[model samples]
Target: MCRMARPRKPLLSRDRIVEAASALVDSEGLDAVSTRRLAAELGVSGPSLYNHFRNKDEILDAVADAVSAQIDLSMFDESDPRDWRAALHDWAVSYRAALTEHPHIVPVLARGPGRRPAGLRVADAVFGAMVGAGWPPAQATYIGALMRYFITGSALGSFARGFVDDETAYDPADYPHLGQAHLLAERRRQVDEGAFETGLRALVDGLSVQYELLAPGGTVRPAPKRS
Candidate 1:
């Protein structure tokens, strides 16, 4: 004659808490994530989350770094030798793909790794790969920073949003070059992807040129000495 309360759903923990918070941010943007809302979403008391995270900021940091963890860092981990340019190109593509999946987190990521384990791992992998390929330590570090700057900056906006179908927006009378600007919106996927590929190749090529001059045949090989 006692009606027991329905078995409570699995109680929340750090991973579940982070997962729910991440879903919230992905759907509604970072501003929408709050301790109260997160607690409600998980059907737990607000104070319970504190047992796992110190505050909303801590949770947000975890969510941001979760994205960093998704990147493919194997190029640095593998024992087999790889062409530096090919390794860099593949890693950048993987990094870009991971970042694009969580575009909402892009702005917060520029806080610069900030002691997050996964974020630090990503930076370490990139720098190690460069240095292992014969890049001078200083140059390797700067090149890593340069790639991060380009990838994160590009993630801040969508190319599709930049175009307008309205021909009036690009009047030939005022600007001749932008006459086909309206068409860009129709080809957003192609244009955005194409632009990233072009820029990445330019960076790799330019770096290769510098490496050849400094180290000779390529970044990893040394020039022959005159007899």
Candidate 2:
């Protein structure tokens, strides 16, 4: 007598598919991912992936949003507006850490702004904090974009080229400026290694200087008021 075959498990779902896809991205580089690859990992056929996601781009967008959800916003809670600099630095560092944790998904974020609820919330929180800190709307937006760009570039570089040597081990005699900063950063790694903090501070400082130069009391002194 022939034996009966075992039935397939009914565990397949969109959420599970996305989770598996995210795991695949975490373990393998983005170039190695595809719907077919995700399906195989999920124990389903390639076409089954489409049943859950419209296409690969949709899957990527979902994955990016999922990664974004991991970012913690509580780092921004501050009583003093002047403390905005420290709070903002902490937020940027945390954001960078979350992105770095899923380095493979960095490209997706760089490619397209994600659609997930958490992703949008993160953006809104950042912009809101900047505005609350007395930055104009446009300046807040620009600052947000600049911070994201810096995080994305660092995450990609750290993944593609490991973090130790380039950022820390430069020769002092040959590159005094880099070497000093590297040593200081190494010490501050206990606090924040200084990538996000340094970059954010410099950007804000530069913007403040520019604003002063352009504002009413600024140094753009009127054009001699002559004929």
Candidate 3:
């Protein structure tokens, strides 16, 4: 008697390909990930990977989205506009912490923007928060861009520390304020962590003043006469 072989499971799936690519990026830097490499990692042929993803860029987009999924958006709540500043600072801090875990993927995020859903979702959330707080479109976009630059810049600096040494050896006479700030930062027990929050809040508060000035009929005050 002839017996039918057991049904075979599907040989490939988009989810499986993306997950494997994500793993590669998490372990190795973005430069280390490739379609051929992913296929080999997945025990499949290079062409088989194309059946799911068009090319390396497509795979990268998928991987970025996958990384974004790991983020918890509850860090920002629509219920409170007053804490929008704290919410945003917390969100950025959490994102920095999260990226630190996957140092390899940080570069990909630092470069690519439009291709991934997660990145867009974050932009949307920031804009939405600003709008909910009654900020104009331009102001919201400006704040979002500023925050992006600060967080990504810090991330890249930390990531590149091995190469840069990240030391600030300045004479007190030459940079007294800088020296004072450095000493104060060094004295704090949670300096590294608290530093980001402190700077973020100060940045947001400064921008809020600008937002008010840019509003209709609001007086554009010149720099408060510097003493």
Model 2's C-alpha root-mean-square deviation from the true structure amounts to 6.6
Candidate 2 local distance difference test against the native: 0.72
Off by over 4 Å in 1: 1-7, 215-227
TM-score-sorted candidate list, best first: 1, 3, 2
Model 1, residue 81: C-alpha shift (Å): 3.9
lDDT of 3 by residue, 47-71 (tens): 9887877889888877776776666
- The order of the candidates by lDDT, greatest first, is 1, 2, 3
* Candidate 1 per-residue C-alpha lDDT over 12-107 given as tens digits, one digit per residue, 9 for 90 to 100: 788898899889888999999999999999998999999999999899899989999998887676674667788888888988888888888888
Model 3: worst 10 consecutive residues (lDDT sum) = 158-167
Q: Pairing residues by index, what is the TM-score of model 3?
A: 0.74
Candidate 3: where is the Cα deviation over 4 Å? 1-10, 75-77, 80-82, 159-192, 211-227
Per-residue lDDT tens digits for candidate 2, residues 1-227, read: 99977767656788887788788888987766798888788788998787778888788788889888888787555554445566667777788888878989998887646467777888888888877766677877887888788778867753212334455476777777665454443454443445555667786677665555444432343434556
Any idea what lDDT model 1 has?
0.86
Off by over 4 Å in 2: 1-10, 76-82, 112-114, 159-196, 204-227
